[model samples]
Target chain A: MRKIKQWTAMGLATVMAMSLSACGSGKTAETTTAAPAETTKAAAAETTTAGATTSTEPVELKFSWWGGDTRHAATEEAIKAFQAKYPNITVTPEYGAWTGWEEKQSLNILGGNAADVMQINWNWIESYSQGGKSFANLEDYSDVLDLKQFTPESLDLCKVDNKLMAVPISLTGRLFYWNKTAFDEVGVALPTDLDSLYKAGEAFKAKDPDMYPLALGEYDRMILMVYYLESKYGKNWVEDGAVSYTEEEVKDGMDFITGLEEKHVIPTLATISGDMADSLDKNAKWIDGKYAGIFEWDSSASKFKKALEGSVNKPGQEFVVGEFVKMGDNNGGFTKISMAYAVAGNSKHPKEAAMLINFLLNDEEGVKIGSTERGIPCSAAGLKILQDNKLGDPLTIEANTKVMNYSKFTLDSKFEHNDLKANPDGVYYKVFGKLSSKELDSAAAAKELIKGVTDTLEN
Target chain B: MKSKGMRKFLAENAGFFFVLPWLIGFILFKVYPFASSLYYSFTNYDLFNGVTKTGMMNYNKIFTDSDITRAFMVTFKYAIFDVPLKLTFALFIAYILNFKLKGVNFFRTAYYIPSILGGSIAIAILWRAVFNTDGLINAVVTAFGGEKINWMASANGALFVIIMLRVWQFGSAMVIFLAALKGVSEDLYEAASIDGAGKWTQFFKITVPLITPVIFYNLITQLCQAFQEFNGPFLVTKGGPNGATTLISILIYNNAFLRHKMGMASAQAWILFLIVMTFTAVAFVSQKKWVYYSDEDGR
Candidate 1:
C-alpha cells in the first residue's frame, strides 16, 4: 500500500510538471488561434447575413479583411450583396481593425485554415509566397475573374516567381496633410516647402509651448527619413535588395528627423509616448488640431479627416491636403499597391473566391457599394463605374492624384519586412526611438539602421 | 507460469484503463510539443517555410546577439523588482485581513477581482490609460500641482508601469497568504503575548516562521510566472522607449510570430526555461534554511 501511494504521487508530479511546461507551446497556440477567432467572431456577428437559398448544393466561402468601421461597413454590405446574387454560395465574413491583424492572418494561413478570400497587404505576396505557392494564382481563375480590368503594370506588382498571386486594389503613397485651421490660428501659412515647415514650427512653438506643428511615430519617422534621403540622392532607399545609401547619407536622413524635433516641427518621441495613443489618428492632440501636420497614406486621409470632424477648429477646413514638401530637387516618396484580394492556395472554392473578388472589384453594383473605401479601385471597370456616378471621397481622390503625380521612387518589397518595420523591436522602431529620445547620436543610429536593413535583406 | 503471472498483474491494475484517456492527451499535447520545442531550438523552423536543420545556429545567435543580451537584462530587472514587492504587499494585506473585522470578506473579494482581470488585455489597456501623460494618474498629479511625468517614454518609467501592473495583481498570493495565516495556531500568539511581545514581534516570531512553507511555495510559483509574463509589456509599452520593457517573452514572441524566426524563438524559450528552473531550484535549496514544518521528520 505504501509503494502504491508513492507511485501515484510520482505520477501526479510528472503530470503537473508536464502541464506547466506545456503552457509555452499549448497556451501560445491557443492564444494565437483564439485572438483571431474572438475578433472575427465579434465581427462576424456584426456582418452575419440570412440570405434565402435558391440552389440545392450550397458552397461556403470565408472572406477576411482589416480596416476602420467605414471599410468594415462597406465590405459587409458588399458581401451581403454577393451572397444575395449567388444564392448557391454562402460567404462567411471575418474582419476587424488592423491591430495584430497580420499576426493572426499569418498564423491562419500557416495553419491552412485562412479565409478563402483575403484582403492582403502588398508585401505579403513577397513575404508569404517566397516560393510562389502560398496564394492561388489569380491568372488561373481568369475565366471567372476579370483580369483585363487591371493594368498589366499593376498586376505585375503582385507577381512573385511568375505567379500572379493577387490583383491590386489601389495604389497609394504617403503625402503631407496639414490642419489649415491650426496653421491659420498660429498666423502661419501651411508649409509647402521644408524651409517654411521649419519656420512654421518655430512660430507655433512661440505661440504655445504645449502645441507642435506635427507628430511622427517611429514608423512614420522611418518612412519620412527614407523620403528625405531619396529626395536628396534621387535613388531608391534600397536597390537590388541592398542598402543603397552610405552611412553618412543615412545619418543625414536621421538628422532630418531629429532636426524636426529640435526645431519643434514635430513632437519628440518622449512627448508622443507620453500621449500613449497607439496611432496618430487616435491621439487626442492630433484629433484636436494641436499637432497640425501628418505624413500619411493617401488612402487613409478620410479617416484622419473624420477624426477631426468634432475639433474646435472649423470642421471642414481641419484636414487640408498640403502640397509635397520641396525637400530636394527629386520627388521623394514611392507608390505601391495599397492592398489586394487573393484566394488562399488551400481554399476549397478557388473559383467562387475568384468570383467574389471580381464582384467586389469589377461588378458595377459591388464597385458602387465599395466606392473608394479601399482607395480608388485599380480596376478600370470599377474606376469607370465610380467616375460615371461622380462617386468617391473628394479628399481621398485629391490626395491620390497628388501622390500619383509626385512620387518617383519604387517601394522595395524589403522596405515593409516585419523585422524592419514591426513596432518596438524592429529596426525602424529601435533606430528612430533611440535617436528621437537622444539615447544614440545620429551617426550611431544611422549605422544601426543600415545594419538592420542589411540583415533583413540577407534573410 | 510467466503468462499466468502477467495476466494476474494486469487484472490487479485494471483501474489503469480509467486514466488512459488522460495519459494519451498528456503525451500528445504536453509531451510532444515540449520535446519538439527542444528539437526546434536546433533548426530553422519558420511556420510557413518547411523546417531546415541548422544545428547550433539559433543557440549561437542567442548568445551573440546584443538584443538577446538586452532582453535578458530587462527580464531580470523586471523579475527582481516585481517578485519581492508583490510578495511583500500580498503578505501585508493578508496579515491585515486575517484579523476578525467587519466586511473582511467583501474586501477579500474586491482584492481578488484584480487577480482575475489583471492578466487580461482589457486591464492592460486600462493600465495604459491610467498611466498616460494625460491619463488619470497625471490628472491627479497635476491637481496636486506636480509636474506630469512621461511614464511611457522614459526607460525607467516604462519598466515601472509594467512592474507595477504585476505587483498590483497580488490578490492570488494574498489569498494564499490569508489561508496560511489562518492555519497558524492562535495559541502561539497567546503565548507570545503572555511573554509581553508586541504585535509585530509576535508576527515575526510566531506567525511568520509558521507560514514559511507557504511563503516558499508562493515564492517559487510567482517567480516562475514573472519570468513568463508577456501581455502587460506587449500591450502597454510594447517594449518601447528604446526597448526598456522588452522582456524575454516579448522577444520570443516577436521572433516567432512577427519575424517568423521560430527556431530562434524556440532557442529563446528554452533559455527562459533554464533560467526559471535555476531560480526555482535555488529557492528550493534556500528554503531548507528558512521554512519550518510541524512534521519535520516526515519532511
Candidate 2:
C-alpha cells in the first residue's frame, strides 16, 4: 500500500512538471501568433488597390533571406524605403546567417506559415518545387516581371522545363584571388595561364622554402578548383556530352594536386585554418599576407576585401579576378543560377506576394534597395541603379562586369552526383571528402562516389 | 476462492500500474520508432519521397562500402581505447574522493561540472579550440619549447583527443563509485586493519569486492554512452583528417538528415543497436563471475 502511494505521488509530480513546461511553451507560441496578427492587420489597412483613387487595403508581406549582418541591415533599409514609396504595402523583413536557415524555412513551410517571399538557393529549386509543392509558377505574372531586362542566361537559370520558378537576385562566378604582396616578394607577376600559375607557385616556393605558395582548405572547394583546372586544360572531366576520362586521367588530376603538396607549393591540409567566418575575421591568414592565392566567388569578394582592409598589418593587398582556369582545351566552367526569391504557392495572398517580389527586383526604388544588399541585382533595372548609385563594393562591380564580359554559362557535371533527390545537400562532400585524404585510392574512390550517387539517383 | 484469484492478479501485476506511464512512453516513442526503423531498413526511404521496399540492398551495400567500414572501424577503435582509459581514470578519482578530506564536496562539484555539460555544443567548441593547430594545447606545447602537434588533424591524433574528452567527463561514474564506497562499512576496514592488512590490501579485498556491483553498472552504462558519442567527433574533427573519426552514429546522422537517406540511416542505426546490445550482453554474462551482491542468495 505504501509503495503504491509513493508511485502515485511520483507519477503526479511528473505529470505536473510536463504540464508546466507545455504551458510555458504554449504561452510563447500564443504571444508570437498574437503579435504578428496585430501588425498584419495594421499593414493590411494601408495596401492600395490597383486602378482605384484611394489605395487598396494595405497588405503586409513578410520577406526572409539569409546573409551577413551588413546584408541584413541593408535589406532592412530597403524594406523601409519600399514602405515609404508604397505607403500601402508594409514589408516585414526577416534575415539570418546561412546556418539553420534551411531548417527554419522547412518548419515554416511545413506549418503553412512560410513568409510570403523567401530567398532560395539554386540547388534547392527542384527540391522545394517538388517536395513542398509550395512555389507558384511565375509564367502568368510575366507582365510585371520584365524578364527581358535580365540576361537570357540568367533568366533561363530560374526556369525549370519552361516554367518560370523564381527571379535570380544575383550572379556568382568563381575567380582566382592572388595576394599581391606574396607574389611581388617572390618576383612573380600574376599568372595568366595555368602553366604560368604553376611556374609562379614554384618560383614562390623557391624564394621561401618555409612558406606554402598556396593555402587551400581541404574541403569541397579544393576539389572543385581541381575540376576547374581540368576543364581549363581542355578536359571536361565530368561535363555532359564530353568524353568522360579514363581512370588514368582522373588519377593524373589527383596526382597533380598531390605533387603540389609534395613540393611544398601547397600547404598541408593541417595549415589551412578558419571557416568562412574565420576567414573573414580581422587577423585571418588570408587577409594578413600569409597565403599567396585563394579561389573565391565574386559575391564574397566584397567581404574578403573588407576583411583585408580591416587587417592590422596591411600588406599591399590587391584582387585580380581571372577566368576560371582551363586545363587542356575547354573554356567553360560550371555556371548555374545563384540564389532566387520565390513566393510560396500555398500563400493566401499570391498577387500581393508577386507584387512585393516585383517591387524588390524590378521597380526603380526597389532596384536601389537591392543594389545595396542583394548581390549584384538580377534585373537590368537593378543593375542600372547599382551602376548609377555606385552602392556596391568597387571590386564586386569590376568582378561582376568581368564575368559578364568573359564567362559562358555551363552545367555542373557533378550535378547528378548531388544527392538532391535524397539528401538535399548531397552526400557528395562526405563521400569525396573521405577520398581526398587517400582513405581510398583513385579507382576505389571513384567507385564509391559513383555507387553513393547512383544509389540515391536510382532510388 | 473467486476473490482470491482477483487478489493474486493485482499483487502479481502491481508494478505495471506503477510504471504505466513509462510503459506507454516506451511503446509510443521507443518501441514504435524501433519497429518502424526495422521496416525502413528494408526500404529506400528518402524522407522527402517517403519509403519504397528495397530488400537487403542497403545492408549488402554496407559490407561493400568503404565509408561504412571506416565508420565501423573508427567507432570500434574509439570504444576500445576510450572505455578502458575512462574506467581506469574514473576508478582512480572515485577512490581519491572517497577519502575524508577538507571541502570534498566542493572538489566533487568542480569535477562534476564537465559531466553536466558533456555533450553540449559549448564543450564541443571548446574541444576544437583546445585541439586546433593554432589552439590552446598546441600553444602550450609550443610555449614549452616543443613542436606543436596537430591533435585534430590526423586520424590517430583525432581519436586520441576524443578519448581524452570522454575520459575527462568521468565525474558521474566517480560519483556513483563514491556512493558505493560509502556503502562499504567502516567495520570491514577496521577488521582488515586488526588482521594487520595494509591500506592497499584492505582496498583490493574488502572495498572493491563490496562495490563490484556498482562498478559493473557504471561500466555498462558508460560503454553504451561512449558508443553513441556523436557530438565530439562530429563537431571537433567533423569526422575527418581522412574520415578517421567518422563513427557509425555520425554516418547515420549524415545519411538521415544531411543526405535524407532515411532507410540507409535506419539500417545503420539498427546495426549500432545490435553492436551495443551484444556488448551489453557480454558484460552481463561476465558479471556473474565478478559482481558481488551484498545479499548473497544473489537475488
Candidate 3:
C-alpha cells in the first residue's frame, strides 16, 4: 500500500512537471510576441505625421537575420544605436544560428509574419522573387537611397532585372588559409599556383604520414577551387549560354580531386565528414602542427586566427593567408554579395521601413554600428566608415582590395534562374566527391549528376 | 427519468469536456495538418506560392528518385538491425534488475539517464566525439596497436554507429518489462521450482509466456520509434559521407523546407506513415499466436 501511494505521488509529480513545461513554452512564445509589439508600436508612432509639419511618429520594425553570437551582439548594439538616434523609431531584432535560418524564414514568409526587413542570401533571391509579389522594389525609393555610394560590383548583386531589390552588406571571396607555425616547422614555403599547392601538400604528407595536408571539408569548396582553376585555364564550365556540363569537363574535374584522394594527401572521406571538428581542436592537427592549410572564406580567417591564439595546448602558434590565387595579376577571383537586407512587401509602413534601412546602411552613425557585423558594409559611405574605424581584419581588407582591383562589375550570375531548382554547388560537390573518393567511379558519377540535374530541370 | 437520461448523456460525453484542450489541439495541430498534408501530397505546393494541383507527379518522381530509394533502404536497414537488438538488450537488463540486488535503483537510474537525453543535441555531439576517426574509440584502438579506423566516413561504419546509438537508449522498454515482471505472482516461480524446472526452464516456460503481451507491446512501440528516427542521423552524421545515412525523415525535411518542395515532402511523409502502419499491422497479426493474457479464460 505504501509503495502504491509512493508510485501515485511520483506519477502526479510527473504530470505536474509536464504541465509546467507546457506553460513555460507558452510564456516564452508570449514574451516573444510582446517584445515585437513594443517595437512595432514605437515604429508606428515615429511614422505618424501631424498637420502642416512632418512630425516624426514613433515607428517600430522587426528585422531578422542568422549569424553567430558575435554577429548577434553586434547587430543588437547597432539596432539600439539606430533607435537612439531616431528617438521615435524602435527596431526589434530576431536572429538564430545558420543551420535552421532558411527553413524558419521561409515559414515566417508563408505565414505572413516575417519581419518588415530581413537579411537574405543571394541563392534565395531567385526563389523568393519567383514566389511572386513578396518583396517591395527598392527602386521606388531611389531618392532616399544613395546607390552611387556603393561599388558598382556590390550594387549589381542587389539589382534584379536592372532594378535594385535589396541592399548588399558585404563583398566576400574565398581564399586559402594555413597554420604559419605548422608550415615553418615543416620547412615548406607556401604554394602560389595549383601545381605548387599540390607539391606543398605532398611535402607536408612526406613530413608526417599520419596528418592530412589539406583540411578539405565539403565538396563544394573543392568544386569551387576546381572551377577557379578551370576559369584560370580559360574554361567556363557553367557558361552563361548552357545549363548542362559537357562530359569531358565533368571528367576533368572529377579526376583532379580523385587523383588527390588516390595519393592520400586529402583526409579519408570519413575523417572529412565525421571528425572535422576534432581534427581542428588545438590538441589535434592545428595544435600539434600536423595539417598545413584550409580553403575558407575571408570571414573565417578571423576564426582560424582566434583558434590558434586561444589554444592552451599549442604554445607560441601563429597562422596567416599565403598569396591567394587571382584570375591573373590583372584579373580578380570571384566576388559576390554575401548577404542583403530587404523590406517585406506586406509591411504596414514600407516607406518608414525603407528609411530605417537607409539609416542602417548610409548614415555615418549607422555605418559605424554596422561595420564588421554586416561584413564590410556594401555602401561606399559604409566602407569609408569602416576604413576610418579600421574595423575589419587586415586579411579581409586585403582580400576586398584585391577583389576591387581586378574583378569586373558582376551581378550574382550563379545560374540564379535555372529551372533546375538545384543548387549546382551541392550537386557538383556530392557527385564529384563521390567520384573522387572512388566511392563512385567517373562513369557512375557522371550518370548520377546528369540524372539529378535533368530531373531538377524537368521538375 | 428524463433527468436521469440527460445525466447519462452528460456522463457519456464527459470525457470530451475533460480532454477538451487535448481534443482542440489534436484537431488544430494534428488533424488539420494531416488533412492538409494529404491534399498537398498531390499538388505542386511551394509554401510561398501556395498549393496548385499537379496530379501525381511528386509521388511518381519518388518512384524514380535515387535519393529516395537510398533513404528508404537506409531506414529499413536501421529498423531491421536496431529493433531486435534493442529488444533483446532491454529484456536482458530488465531480467537482471528483477533480482533483489544492492544498488539496483542506482543502476536503473544510470541506464535511464541516457534515454532521457537520447534525443538531445548534446548526446548527438557526444556520439560524434566517440565515433569520429581520431575520436576516443579510435585512440583506444590505436593504443592497442590497431590501425585507426574512420568510423563516420564510410557508409557501413556510419550506419553501425547510428544503430548502436539507438540500441543504447533501451531504458524505456526495459522499465516497462521490469514493471511487468514485478506484477507476475511469486507463487508461480515457486510452483515451477517444485515441478523440478531449472532457472532457464522456469524463465522460458513461466516468465516468458506470462510476459509475452508486454514483449508484443514493446516490439510495436520500438519499431515505430525506429522508423521515425531522425535526430540521431541528422545531427550525428548529417546524412553524409555520400548520403549514406539519409533517412526518410531527413529526406522529407529537405524536400519540404530546404528545397521548398512541400508537396513532395508531404507525399514522402505519407509514404512513411503507410510503411509504419503496414509493419505495425503485421506485428499485431503475429501477436495472436504467441501473446498470453491473464484474462483469456474470461474472454
Candidate 4:
C-alpha cells in the first residue's frame, strides 16, 4: 500500500510536467495561429484597393523572409522607408535563418497564420496553392505589383493554375568552387574535369590523409547525379512530376557516387554530418580547408568565399572559382527562380502587402535599400537600378554567368521534395547510407532508390 | 424537496468549479487531439489539401511498408539493450552512493547533470562531436598510438553511440533508486544482521525486497522511454549510416512532417501507443511475481 502511494505520487508528477510543457507550446501556437486569419474573399480588387481607401487606417502587416544579416538589414531598412511613406501602415519584419524555415512556414500556412507578405521558395506555390486560393492573386493587386516590370517568363514561373501566386526574386543554380590554398599546399593541381577530379582524391589524401577533394551532402550528391545523368543520357532526373531514371541508370549513378567514395573524391556523408553545421558555409572542416571544394549555389557562393577569407585562424586561404566538373558530354547545369515573395490569401490587406512587395522589388527608394540583398533581383527595374549603381556582388555575377552559359537542363521543383533529404525514412538518405555503409551494394541500393522515388511520386 | 437536495449537493460539490480551468484545458488540449488523431488515422490527411476519408488504407499499408518494419525492429533492439543496462547501472550507482562517503553530494550532482542536458539538441550535437571521425574520441585514441575509428560512420558504431547517450542519462532512475534505498527501514536490515546474516545476505534479504517496487517502477518507465527515444538518433546519427538507429518515433515524425503523410503517421502513432501500452501492462501484471510491497498483508 505504501509502495502504491509513492508510485501514484511520482506518476502524477510526471504527468503534470508533461502536460505543462505541452500546454506551454500549445498556448504559443494558439496565439500565433489566431493572429493571421481575419480576411475574407476580396474577389474584385479594383483601382480603389491600391490607391484610395484605408490610407489613414492603422494597419499592422507582418512581412517575413529567411536570409543572412545583409538581406535582413536591407529588408528592415526597406520596411522603414515604406513606413515613412505610409505613416499609418506599420510593417513588422520577421526574418530568420534558412534551416527548418520552410517546414515552419508550411505549418504556419496550414494554420492560416502566415505573414501578410512572405518570402517563399519556388516549389511552395505548387504545394500550397493546389486546392484553393492559398495565396492572394497578385493579378488582383497588379495596380501595385507591376507585372509589366517583370518578364512574362519570370512571372509565369510563379503562377499556379493561372493565379499570380508569387514573384521571382532571382535565378540560382549550383557551380563548383575550389579552395586554392588547400590545393596549393597539397601540391596537387585542382581537378578541372571529372576524371581528374576522381584521381585528385588519391593525390590529396596521399599528401594529407585529412584532406578530401570535395565535401558534398546527400542532396548535393543527388544534384551532381542529376547533372551527370543529363550529361550522359541527355535526360533530366525528373520529368512530369516523376523520377525519369531507369533502374540501370539509377544504378549507374549510385555506382558513380560509391565510386567517388571509393576513390576518395568526396568525404562520406557521415564525415560531413559530424560538423553539425546547417550548411558548408559554417562547417569547420570546410572553413579550416580540410575539405577543398564544394558544388553549391552561386548566390550562396559568397558565404563560402567569406568563410574562406585569409584571416587570423586560417590565414592565406585563397578562394577560387572552378569550372563545373565535366561529368559527361552535356555537363548539365541550370538555374531557377531561387526564391519569391508571395502574399497570403488570409492577409487582411492584400493590396497593401502587394505594395510592400512592389516597393522592395521595384520602387527606386526600396531598390536603394534592398539592392542586391536578394541576389541580383530578377525584376527588370530592380536589376537596372543595381547595375546603374554597380552594386552586384562580383562572385555572384561571375558564377551565374558561367553556370547559365554551360548548364543545359532546366530545373524541376519536385526534385527538392522533403522525402529526398538526408533525414530518417528519407529515400535518398536511406539508400545512400546503405551504399556507403556497405550494407547494400550499389545495385541493391539503386533498386531501393527507384522504389523510394516511385513511392514518393505515387503519394 | 428535490430542488433543496440539488442545491445542497451543489454546495457540497462546489470545489469542482475551482478545478474547472484545468479540466477544460485537459479536455481541449489533451483529449481532443488524442481523439482527433484516432479519427485522422482513418482518413487521408495532408497539411495543405485537408482530410479525405480513406477507410483502412493507411492501416493496410503499414504492414507492407518495409521502412515501418525496419523502424520497429531498430526501436525494439534499442529498447532491449538500453533498459536493463540503464537500470542495473542506476541501481548500482544508487547502492554505492547510499554508503556514507565524503563529497558524495557533489558526485550526485555531477552524475545528474548529464541527465538534465542529455535529451536536448545541443547534447545530441555534442554526442556527434564526440563520435565523429576526427572527434575527441579519435583524437584521444590516436594520441595513445591507436588507429582512428569511424565512430559515427559505421552502422554498429552509430547505434552504439546513440545507445551510450541513452545509457549515460541514468541519473533519473538512479535518483529514484536512491530515494527508495533511503526509505528502507534500518531495523529490517539490523534484524537480518543480528540473525547471522552477512552484508550481502542482509542486503538481498532486507534491502532488495523492500526496494522491489521502486525497481518495477523504474523498469516500466525506462523501458517505455527507451522505446520512444528520438533526439539522440534524430540529431546525432539521423537514424543512419543505413537506418540502424531509426527509432519508431523518428519514423512516425518523419512520415508526418517530411513526407506529408499525416494519416499514415497517425496510424503509426496508434500502433506505437498500443505497443508501449502492452509493454507497460505486461510489466504491471508480472510485478506480482517478484515485486514485494512493504505494506501488503500486514508486513
Candidate 5:
C-alpha cells in the first residue's frame, strides 16, 4: 500500500509537470507582455451576447499579433473600427510581446487551434507548410481581400509553390546606430570607415575602460559576417539550396570579426552578455552609455534611440544613425519581410478572416489606426496614408529609408531558420561566440560553422 | 464461502466509483499519449501535414545525427553529477532536520521552500539573473576585489549554474529523506551510541541501512528528473555557450516543436524512456541486496 502510494504520487507529479510545461513554454511572453488569450476570450464573449438577438450569422474571428503598448493599442483600435464598419463581423484582438511567440504559435498550430487571423513570420510559412496546406491560400478569398493593393513583387515573395501562404508586411534589414553623446564624451569622432572604427574603438576603450565602442552579441557578429561577405564578394550566403561560401571564405569573415575583438572594436562576448538583456534596446548598459553603438534592424532603430531614457545621456539628440563601415564598393545590406500576417487554413470563417486581414492591410480606417505600428505599412496606399498623417517615428523612417536605398541583396527563406542562427550551438552563435570569446581560432570555427550551416540548410 | 463473501462486500460498498475520474484521466492523458508517442517514433509525423509511416527512418536519422549523441552526453554528464550531488545534499539536510531540536518544523519548512519554488519558470529566470555578469553573484564577487565572472557566457559556468539550480531544488528529496529518517526507531540509534560508535559510524551503520528503501526511491526520482531537466536550461542559458548544457529533453523539444520534426522528437523521447527504465530496473535489482524493511523477511 505504501509503495502504491509512492507510485501514485510520482505519477501525479509527472502528469502535473506535463501540463506545466505546456504552459511554461510561453512563460517568457506572458511575463514580458499580457497574454492574448484572456482578452481574446472576453471580447468574443461580449460580442456573442451583443449580437445574439439581432444577428442572423454573427462571425467572431481571432486576430493575434506581437507588439508593445503602442502596437497593441493601435491594433485594438483597428479592430474596433473594423467592428463598427461591419457589426456582424466581430474581431477579437490578441496581442503580446515577441518573446516566446514562436513557441506558442507552433503549439497552437499543432493543436489546430491557432487564431483565425494570424500575424506570422515569413519563414514560418516555409517551415510549417508541407503538402501545400499549412496556411490558407488568400487567393481563395480574392473577393473579400483587395489583393491588388499589394505590389506583384511583394505578393510573389510569399508564394510557397504558387500558394499565397502569407502576406508580406514590410521589408527590413540591419544598419548601425551610435549614441553620439557617448562618442563626444570619449573625445572620439564617429567612425566613417572600417579602419577609423578600429581606431575609435581603441580611443574610446582607453578613455573609459568600462564602455565598449560597439556592443555585439554572437548573433550580431553573424549578421556582420553575412553583410561583410555579401558586400565584399557579392555572394549570397546560400545559393542553389546550399551554402555558397567555402570554409576558407567563411573563415575570412570570422577572422575579420575576431580582428575587431583584438582591436577592441567590439565588446568581448562576455562583456556585452554581462548586461544579460535580450535586446540592446532594453539593456541597461546600453541605456547607461556603456555601449556607444548598435547593429540593429532598420525598423527597430527608434527603440534603441528611445531606450536612452532616464539615462545620464541626453535622450533626444544623442541618438544618430552611423555611417556604413566600408566593406567593399558593393552594397551587401539586405531586406526581407519584417513579419507576415496570414489566415489559418483550419479557420471556420475564412471569408471573415480574410476580410479582417484586408481591412488591416488595405482599408483606409485600418491604415490610419494601424499607422506605423507594424513597421510602416507594406501596401503603397497604406504607406502613403501613414506618410500623410505623419504617424511614423522620424528616426525609424529615416533609418529604414537609408537602408532601403543602400541594400543590394535579399535573404533566402532558408536563412531565416532560427535553429541555424540563434539557438545554442547554432551556426551563427557557436562559431562567432567561440571566435569572439577566444575559445576557438577562426579556422577551426569556420570549419565547424560550415558543417552547422550545411546541416541546417539541407535538413 | 470466500467467493460469496467477495460478492457481498462488492454489493455492500461499491466505492470504486469514487475513483472513476482518476481512471478516466489516466487512460485519456497518460496511457493514450504514452502509447501514441511510441507509434509516432516509427513514422514521419510532422503534425501539420500528416503522419506517414516510415519504419525505422527516425531511428536511423537519430543514429546518423551527431547532435543526438552530443545531447545524450550532455544529459548523462548532468544526471551523473546532479542526481548524486542533490540527493547527498538532501540527505545531509534531512539528517540535521531529523534531530530532536527546537524549531525543527520551521527548519524543515524553510528547507522545503526551494522545492516549492523549483518547478517554476520564474526560478529559472532568477537563476539566470543571479548568475549573469551584473547579477547578484558578480556584484558580490566585485565587492570582494574580484573581477566579474562570465557565469552565463562561459561553457563551464553555464553548466555549473544549471547544475546548481537542480541541486538547489533538493528540498523535495530532502522532505522524503526526513520522513524516512524520522520513521527509523530511536532505539536503534540509542543502542548504537551505547556500543562505542561515533556519530558518523552510527549514521552509516544504523541510519543509512534503515533508509535504503527511501534512498532507492530518491535515486530513481532524482536520476529520472535530472535526465529530463528542461526548464532550467531552457529558461536560463538555452543550452548555450556552445550546447555545453543541452539536456536531452531540450533536444527533444527543439526537434518536436521548433523544427516541426515530431518523428525525431518522438524517437528521442522513446530512447529517453528506455534509458530511464533501464536505470530504474537496475536500481530495483540492486535494491534487494541492500534495502531492508522490518516486515520484508516476514512477507
Candidate 6:
C-alpha cells in the first residue's frame, strides 16, 4: 500500500512537469487553429481594396509608434480619421515617448505579437528584418499603399534583399542650431566655419566661463567624428558593412573631438553627464542659453526651439538654424530616413495595414492632419498638401532645407547598430567616454573604436 | 471501499492541493526560465534569430572578455562596499531606535519609508537629482564656500553615489535588527552591569552574540541583493561616464536586450548566480564560528 501511494505521488508530479513543458506546443496549436480565421479576414480586406463592395466585417489592428506629445496627438488624430473612413475597422493606437520603445517593440516582434503597423527606425530593417522576414514586404501590398507617392531613393533606403521592409516617412540630417540670444549675450558673431567656431568658443569663455559655443553628447560626438572623417576622406563611414577608416584616420577623428573639448567648442563628457538631463532639449543649460548651439537632427529643431522659447532666464529666445560647417573640402553630413512605417510579417490584415499607411501618407485628410510633425513628409502628395496649406513648422522646414541641400554622404545602417550606439556598453559610448575622462588617449581610443566596430562586424 | 480510499487520499494530500497554484506558478515562471536560460547559455541565441548550439562559446567569452572582467570587478566592489556599509548603518540606527524615546514609532516609520520606496524608479531619479552637479548636495556645499563636485561624471564619484543609494536604503535591515535587539533580555545587561561592564561592553559581549543569527541572515540576503543590484547604477550613472559602474546585472541586460545576445546574457547570469551561491555557501560555512543560537548546546 505504501509503495502504491509513493508511485501515485511521483506520477502526479511527472504529469505536472509534462503539462508545463508542453505549454509552448499548446500555444502553437492554438495559433495554427486561428490562422484560418485570419486568412478569411485577409481575404475580406483584399476584396474591399480590390474595388469590390466593401466588407462590413469588423477588423481590429494595433498600430504603435514612439514620439513626443505633439506627434502622439497628431498621430492619434490621424488614427481617429482613419477609423472614421473605415468604420468597420478599429485601430488601436499604442504610442509613447521614444525611450525604451525600441526594446518593447523588438520583444513584441520576437514574440510574434507585433502590431499590424509600426513606426520603425531605419536601422530596424537591418536589425530585426535583415533576412527580409520580420516585416511584411511592402511591395506585396503596393496595390493599396501607393509606393509611388514616395521617392525611389527613399524607397531604396528601406529595401533589403529586394524586399521593401518599410516605407520612409521623411529624410533628416544633423545640422548646427544656435541660440541667437546666447551668442549675442557673449558679444560674438555666429560661427560660420571651424575657425570662427573656435574663436567664438574663446570669446564665450572669456565673457561667460559657464557658457560654451556648442555641446555635443557622446553619440553626437560619434556622428560628428564620422562626418569629419567622411568629409576629409570622402568615403562612407562604413563601406560594404565594414569600418572604412584606417587606424590612423580614426585617430585623427578622435583627435578632432578632443581638440574641440580642449578649445571648449563643446562641453566635456563630464559636463554633459553632470547635467543629468538625458537629452539636450531637456537640459537646463541648453534652455538657459549657456550651451549656445547643438549638433542635432533637423527633425528635432522645433523641439529645441520650443524648449528655448519656454526658458525662464531668456524667454522668447531666438533659436535659428545654423549652417553645417565644412570640416574638410567636402560636405560633412549624411541624410538619413528619420523614421518609417512597417507592417509585421505576421499581421493578420496586411492589406488593411497598407491602407492605414496609405491614408497617413497619401490621403489628403491624413496628410493635412499629420503635417510635418514627424519632419517634412517624404511622400510627394503629403509634402504638396503641407506646402499648399502652409502647415509646416517654419524652423523645421528651414533646418530640413539646409540638411537636404548640404548633406552628400551616405550613412550605412551599421553605424547605428544597437551594439555600437547603445548608451553605456556601446562602442561609441565607451570609447568616447573614456577619451572624455582622459582614461584613454586619442590614439588608444581610436584603436579601441576600430577594434570594437570590427568585432561587431565580424560577429 | 473505493470511495473511502479516495477520501483518505484527498484528505492526506489537502496541504499539497492548497499549494498547487503557487507550485504551478513556480514551475512555469521560475523553473522554466531558469532551465531555459541554462540551455541557452550553451547556444548562440540572439533572441531574434533562432538558437544554434555552440558549446562553451558564450562561457568562453565570459571568462576571456575584458569587458566582463571589468563588470565583475565593478560588481564585486559594489557588493563589498554596499553590504558592509549598509549592514553597519542599519545596525547603528537599529541600536539607537532600540532606546526608549518620544514618538519612537514615528521615527521608525520615517526611517523605514526609504526602503519601502528604495527600489522604485522615482527614488533613483531622486538620487540623480540630489547628486548632480547643480543638485541640492552641491547647493549645500557651495553655500558652505565649497566648489561643486561632478558626482555623476567621474567614475569614482558615480560609484560612490550608487553606494550611497544602497546605504540609504538600510531600512529593511534596520527593522530586522531592531526586532533582534528587542528580543535581547534586559537581564543580560543587568548581569553585565553587576560584573562592572559598560553599556558598550554589554552590547558587544551580550547583545551582539544573541543577534548574530539575524546578522547572518541579513548578511546573506543583502550580499545576494548587492550582487544583483541594477536599478541604482542603471538609472543614475547608466553604467558610466566610462563604464566604471557597469555591474554584472547591467552587463547582462545590455547583452540580452540591447545587443540581442541572449546566449551571452544567459552565460553572464549563470556566472553571477554561481558567484552568489559560492559566497552564500562560504558565509554558511564561516557562520559556525561566529553565529551563536540560544537553542544550541553552548551553555
Each candidate's interface RMSD (Å, one decimal) is 6.2, 5.7, 7.9, 8.2, 8.0, 5.4
Judged by DockQ cut-offs, the docking class of candidate 3 is acceptable
Question: What count of clashes does model 2 give?
Answer: 21
How does candidate 1 fare on TM-score? 0.91
* Model 3 chain B poorest ten-residue lDDT run: B10-19
Give the TM-score ranking, best first: 6, 1, 4, 3, 5, 2
TM-score of chain A of 5: 0.86
CA lDDT, every prediction?
A: 0.85, 0.67, 0.69, 0.79, 0.78, 0.86
**Against the true structure, whose DockQ is highest?**
6
Off by over 4 Å in 4: A1-54, A273-279, A310-313, B1-6, B15-20, B192-201
Write one digit per residue (lDDT tens) for candidate 4, span B237-276.
Answer: 7776667788889878876765567888899899888889
* Tens-digit per-residue lDDT, A220-329, candidate 4: 77788778788788887778877788889988988899888889888777776555454677677888898899999887888888888834568778887898788777
- What tens-digit string does per-residue lDDT give for candidate 2 at B1-299? 88678556656766665566666667866999999999999898876567766799889878897668778888989998898888778888888888989998998998888899886768877776777666788789999999878664466887887888889999888889888888888998998899999989998998888889988998899889888998777666666655667788887876775556789999898888899999999999999899998788953
Per-candidate DockQ values are 0.35, 0.26, 0.31, 0.34, 0.26, 0.42
In the predicted model 4, the residue pairs found to clash are: A333-A407
